[model samples]
Structures are given as structure tokens and as C-alpha cells.
Target: MSLEWLQRVFGAKVLQFVMILFTYETEEECNTIKDDLKRNPDLKQLLEKCGGRYLTCNKMMNNQSEMRDLMKKIEHLFNENQQQCYTGEMPNTASIRKKKLESSEHQCGHTSEMESNAHLNLILLGKKRAGKSASGNTILGREVFMSKKSSKSVTRDAAVKSGTVNGFPVTVYDTPGFYDPKMGTEEIQKILDKVLLKCESGPCAFLLVIKADSFTEEEIKTVEKIEKLLGEERLNKTWILFTRGDELQEENITINEFINDTEALKKLIQKYDQQFHVLNNKIKGHSDQARLLLVKILQRSFGIK
Candidate 1:
């Protein structure tokens, strides 16, 4: 809505965004649009003072409707809310990229690898028996968090486990399940706040664990509650991690095909930019998949090449 609100989500500096628009009459008339923007008396001075690359689409002129809609979408970025802060001097293209890479690193640890590589602090959250603890153990490459069959949540308090994956140190925080009739809202919030204290620099990712075999309307409501708690800003980094990957194998279907076929799951993933991953916590040799998951998390945390 407001430019100030958008600036807060993206950042306070113009360095993070560097798109400059230019108009072109015809594709055949000019091979370059930079020259046009440079020649225009108004734009020429503007470019000299604040250098930026020009993005020109010939269709913008030929299709006014599409151009207007596209402009509106671009303006929304300016109007989007700022989720994190960037302090100190303004960065150049290289510096901005480097900062993103640094953000990918886990910040809740003091290991040497954590210092050099991107550190990731991932919190596993979901309802009881959704396999959050098992998912954590799977990602960490060990049974750091207990996973067992139970009517009640196995993890009463938030527990953290750390390990290295593909040279990057990843920290996993297994939090208690939601909608616990015994626990009050204030208690759950307090537990979350305590777990978040370790993430002073902010978490690289949030894993919303769900069983692959079943996701009901009640579970959807639970997800909505989680989303509300995280808010729009943090939800961008949240990943819908569907556990019990063995079910997909047994069904002889891929995760993509499964979600695409399921109407409810389809919409859920789409709402979050299709940011979801599958894992069979019971399966052995999950290191590869875990690494693959880490790769996605890093790309989501940093910038995909």
C-alpha cells in the first residue's frame, strides 16, 4: 500500500533493487534502449547521477493492458512490507549478493563452519503426530529428537539439534504441537519466544511438518493458525515439509504429481509459492535428500543462481 511499508520488508536501501524502465517505439528502429534513456533530457541526467540497468519490453507499448498490469505488480514490490533490516553502508551489486549469501548461513551457532559458510536455523512445527520430531532427526542425520507413536506430543518443550549438511551447519529446533487442549495460548507463545531467542540473527527457514498420507480440513485450520502466528513476513521463509515420504513411494507417485492432483494440497503449496519438500523420515540413506533440501533452503535463503 505505502512505499514506506514496502521499504521496510525489502530494505531501506535502493541497492537491493536496481531495475530502471525505458520505452522503445519499435524493435527494428533501435538495437539499444539504454541510448534512448540516456538521450532523453530528463532521464539522461537521472541515469548519470544514479546508475542502474534498464529493462525494456517491446510489448509494453504494443500491449497497454498488459503493461499497466505489469506496472501495478512491480509497484506492489515497492508497496510490500519489509521483513528484515540491513544496517551500515549502502552496498553495490556485488555487496548486495554477498549479503544474501551471508544470510543463508546459520547464525545461532559459533562453529567455524557456521562462520565461513551459510548457517541455517530451521524450526520444525506442526500438530501432534505430524512427524515434526522425526523430520528434524531426518534432517539432522541422527536421532537427536525422539520420534515415536503417541496420542500426545512427544516433545513437550522446544528442543534444538545442530549438525552439518554439505559443509553448512544447520540448526533444527523441534517445537511442541499446536491445538493442545492442555496448554494455553500464552504458554505456546512463550515456548516459541524462548526457542527464537537462539535465532538472534533470524532463522534461515521454518519447516511446517505434515504427514504426506493425510491432510484434513482440521489440519488445514492448524496450518492457518501457524501462518497467522508467523505473520506474512516470516511465512515467506516457511516450507511445507510433508513427512512420511514412503507413502508416496507405496502409492507409486511423485510428490509433485501428488500435490498437483490433490485439490487442497495444491492450493496450500501455491499459496506459499509452491515452497514444499518431501521426506521419508523412516527411510535410510536420507543424506542425499537432506542435502537436496538444504540446497533448496539455501537458495531460498540466499539467491538462486
Candidate 2:
């Protein structure tokens, strides 16, 4: 897209957010390109050096600068659909929850058992070594999902574990890491697509896990990509869960203060209407963080608040 068209569509700042935040392709397509780039070292370097010979053949100025500019505009155009969600208009949480509850209530026949023992369907999303499985264990209040460090991936596919948290029957789907640009193998993609089946009654919410210690540029892009893939509807139901709360405690800073330090992180929290909570996955047993997460989900997903 031309810079002029971008300016007209979502203004300059949104354009910057998109350009710097996500790639110029759908989630699957972008992953495939990244895979190809990694598999071919020479081709990858060529892409890095020239962007593409044909695209830069006509350029007389610095090739790298032109390529960077071209990429930003391309990414901005690809992420144009998400622009509507953050065009300076905030989402009404009550209305969103009411719409979700209408369907959830329908599936349960509005019965007392369903009402008193409602299940919260949560899908955890994040990158490698981002503590997704550990977070699941923390929420389940047990070792339902093995939590350990490794050079490779911990959760290879999606796994569902159901348990009660704060009086709510909670079903959590722990998804494999997809933060690596080339991580979307067919099997991983298939599992991610299937993870939402837990909410056949209509999925209520998604939990985006980010480590409080380091909210890097790549992590920011992962958030944007997942947000785009989930689309605006599910994103409204999405909550940001920062894992490794101990880091925040060590730094002796509140999440609000940390968010204020970074523009991209701030924008993400604002996009979700400040629906974020922290989890110290390293904690051994039941956690107050898990309880608070359940409460927030009830309010955000079922209008319980």
C-alpha cells in the first residue's frame, strides 16, 4: 500500500503500530514464507540484502533503506483489517459479555447446574519458553501439564486439562509455541485450529501469555499476529496473562508502571481494555493469581461481575 493510502485509512500512528508490529501476510502464509527463508540460507540473505532484485532493480538509493520502507508499508496493508478494532474507539465489555452469555446460556438451557457450575473455556497462546504449560499447571493447581525448561519445545501440540478454579469448572487448552516465525508446521497449525473445540458451545475467551521479565519486539509481534488471527470478536474476549510474576516483584514495579514504560505494550493493554493479570507459574500449589484470573474471565466472558 502507498503511504498516502495508509495515512487515509487508519492515520499515521496506527500505521506505525502495524508496520512495526506484524508482518504483511496472514498468519499461515507468513509462517510458510519464514520457513522457506530459514530452509534456504542463500535465498534468505538475498532477501535481506536486496529485498528482491526485481523490486529493487529500479531503486537508485540505499537498497536496505528502500527495502525497510517497502516492508513497513506492506505489513501495514496486510494488517489493515485489525485497524477497525483500535480506531480510537473502545469496546463495551458489558455488551460483549452479554452477547457471549446469550449463546452460552442457550447451550446450557439456562439451567441452575450450568449457571452455578459454569465452565470457562480458556485457550493459552504464546511463544516458545513463554511458560504456557507452567501457566496451565498453575491454573489447574497441579502438575496437569509438565513444567520444565528445555532447549526445544515443551508443549508439542494442544492438550486439554479440566479442573475447578475458584468454584468454576475450568477447561484449559495449552497450545504449542508458535512465536518462532517458522514454527507453524502443519501439525502445529492443525492443533491450534482444533484447540477451540473445547468451547463447542462457543468459545468464551483466549489467554495470551507474555513473560513479565521481557516483553521484546518479537513478543509484541506475536501478540499482534495472534490478535489479528483471532480477529476482533475473540480479541474482545481475550485477556493478557503475564507469566513469571516473580520478575515484576524482583524489579519492584507494578505492571501498570511497566506498561507505561513501553508504547507497544501499553497499546496492547489498551486494545484489550486493560484486561490483564499476572501469574507466578513457579509457585507450587494453588495461587491467588489463578483465582483472580477466573473471576476476571467470569466477568469478561459471562457478565458475572
Candidate 3:
């Protein structure tokens, strides 16, 4: 909902593309936001100030087909812009597929080796208020995505931001939380479909974010829903990213100790061959926690080591 992140990474032109998609829950809502944008003179000036013509957002009002076409157009433009900066950032999808097919036999159920120069796509997934958004900011080492503590979900749609982490081009997709009462089943499915498309970049690391303190019945059901959505095939690409390590530290408990004490958590980690990382989002500024986690992800998920 915050344009700060979009405006910071991308200019106002991309914001037009994002504004259309962000409020695109229903045709009615999309139309309402479109009308609002039209009436806002400052928004018009903002685009003009950025040397961008105001377009596409109006075109999306007609039908879903138009909206879909606009999405593809904007996404291509965005990726093209991003690829211009980082050398070999996102590899050709066809070549990635070919390489994965060739290396499938050697991959013992893990994701295939990523292109040497390819960027890492880290998809954050979990229940609402599980610190997924905050973890995203932590990983990026900046507050690009909005984060706060509230009963309501902060991220209502899928938002992405990219930056270099430890010299690797990393893009983080912060998705809406699972089992969010605010979101309908169909809406959730649409989000999943979009995210899966991004995953085609190849060798994505699916970080299942959860609080470090407790794993309750609700958390158990949430994990089941995540597994079902990801499917057993993607289990290899998944890793448990436990947030709020500061809480565990307060109680003099290690992440491993917390998991060992919780039977469900212990078994879940074992299910993924002990692939996990703990992040203390409270401890910001020049911390190596995020860097270390990326290293582990690259080594385990992408075979970068």
C-alpha cells in the first residue's frame, strides 16, 4: 500500500503499473482506484515530473484481458530495466530450463545449480503477522517494504524489491500472509499463480517465515496450508526462516534449542533435512545475520558453494 518502496527503487512510471495491480482485488475496486488517481492532480504532476507519460492504468479499466496485457508489458519493462544494471542478473528462462533438465539426474531432489551470474529470488511465505515483511526489510538491509505490528495484515498483495547482498543480485518477493481472513480463496490463488511465475527464474529459495517463540496449533495448520500450496515437489527448495531471534536470546535459548523443545518444529526441520535460518530483525545496522543466511541459501538451495 506504501508507494515509498516503489518510488525508491523504481521511478514514477513503474508506480503506475504497481498502482493498478495493488488494488486489483476486484474489477470494482480497480475502477474506484483508477478514478481516484485521475482526480489527483499531484499524481499527474508526479508522473510528468519524472518525465513519464500517464498511461496503462487507464487501459486496465476495460477488462481482465487488458489488465493481463498491461501486467506483462510493465513486467517486461521492469525486468529489462533491472537487467541493464546487473551483469547476467536474470538468465534466459529457456536456457535455465534446459540446464535444469540436463542437471536433474545429478540433483538429489534439491534445486539445480543456478547460473553463475544469476540473481537469487527469495520468496517469503507464512501466516499473517509472522514477520515476513520485516524479514524482507532485514534481508534487504533497508525498510523498502512496509512493516508494523497490528491485527490486520500489512501486505495485502505481492510486492517485490531487488538489491545486491554480499555481491549477489537478490530480489525478494514479500507475499500476503496465508490464512488471512481479509483475503478470499480465489484472491489467494491468484496471488499464488503470480508468485509461481516469478519462481520460474530458477533456483528460488522459498523462506517460510515464522516467529521464534512458539509453534502453536494455528501455526501447524498454517504449515500444512503452505506445504499444500508449495506441493511436495517444492519441499526441497523450501527452508524455515525463524524470525525474532531476539526473543529467543532474551530467554537464553538457541534456535536449535527452541526447535528441539517443540516437537512439531523439530520434525518440520527434519522433513527439510535441517534447512533453516534464524533472524533477529530487532538487531539492525551492519549485522552479518542476513549475509550469513544468504550464504547458507546459496550453498544449500542453489549449490553455489
Model 2, 126: alpha-carbon shift in Å? 0.6
Which segments of candidate 2 are over 4 A away from where they belong?
1-117
lDDT by residue for model 3 (165-254), tens = 655568899999888998976787789779889765566888999899899999999889888888898889899999999888898998
Model 1: CA > 4 A from native: 1-117, 200-203
- The lDDT values for all models are 0.72, 0.70, 0.75
Candidate 2's clash total is: 0
Query: Which scores greater on lDDT, model 2 or model 3?
Result: 3
**Clash pairs, model 1 backbone:** 6-80, 8-82, 9-81, 9-82, 9-83, 105-118, 105-119, 106-118, 106-119, 106-120
- RMSD (Å) of each candidate, 1 decimal: 15.7, 21.3, 18.3
Per-residue alpha-carbon lDDT of candidate 1 for residues 1-305, written as tens digits (9 for 90 to 100): 12222233344465344345555568654456656665677566544433443456564467676477657746654455253333445435436765665566436443343234346799988888899988888887888888899888888899988887755567899999988777776788888878777773744688998888877887898899888777788888899999979889998989988788779889999988878899988865347788888878766755532
Estimate, for each residue in 20-132, the C-alpha lDDT of model 2 and write its tens digit: 22233244755665676669785555444432321221124445765786776666554654544344532244335545766787687774423534456789898888898
Which residue ranges in model 3 land beyond 4 Å of their true spot? 1-113
